[model samples]
Target: MSIPLDSPALALRAALHAALVADAALLALLGGPRIHDVPPAEADFPFVALGEAVVADWSTATEAGTEHALTLHVFSRSGGRAEAYAVAEAVAHALHDAPLALAGHRLANLRATTAEVRRESDGRTFHALVRFRAVTEPL
Candidate 1:
């Protein structure tokens, strides 16, 4: 079935972006509020970018809801994986079980599911992939 025009996933994403940008802990790790849906070609190192998001129907007999599998990418050129991992920890601490306000949906639950940090193919850049799982119900 086709998804509704006013999708909860969109609302959830907006909320996530706002929350991440406003989180002081996460911002400090990045040296600024460098959170973006798509980073520019010259974006500074040690920044967080919104990555993939997979949405699925999670409706009950009487309730409409959604399940979101979201990924946030952390990029850094710092000497080692330490910086990337630190940023990932801040991201997880800010989001896990946090109450977020969405436009037309209520966040039922949000949790940091997984995080992985590794050196990219370039061999200099460190990449941290932080994944989150969230459930939202339309308001």
Candidate 2:
């Protein structure tokens, strides 16, 4: 079942979306990727996508309340800086758009700090820590 847009979950999703949209360089990096699918699971939120040469899996903590973390994983046929940034951008945008459903959730605060970009044999990956404060009242 989907939670109401006013729920805390929706608030968190919105904060994530804002964070991704705020970064242009990140967006450019993650361009031309297709959103494969999103699965419903506890603990981690996953968005799967297919890039030019790789498949990326971005997972983040979807816990309700305050202080959450997000991780992006890139799996590619070849590894490069451009590929890494692209994956990061896509993941960021996904998070930014995540909260579009929450209309009534009040965004008390949102802060995206602590960003890390890494390169591996598979591809490049970016990790970000997103902190937000929101409140949802019963109707």
In terms of TM-score, which candidate is strongest? 1
For model 2, give the 10-residue run with minimal summed lDDT. Answer: 50-59
Task: Quote the positional error of residue 14 for candidate 2 in Å.
Answer: 4.6
Per-prediction TM-score to the true structure, in the order listed: 0.95, 0.38
**Candidate 1, 54-134: lDDT as tens digits:** 998899999988899999999999999999999999998989998999898899999999999989999999999999999
The CA lDDT of each predicted structure is: 0.92, 0.38
- Model 2 residue 94 distance off true place after TM-score fit, in angstroms: 11
Query: Model 2, 27-73: lDDT tens per residue?
Result: 45544222232323431212223211111222246423333343334
Q: List runs of model 1 lying over 4 Å from the truth.
A: 1-5
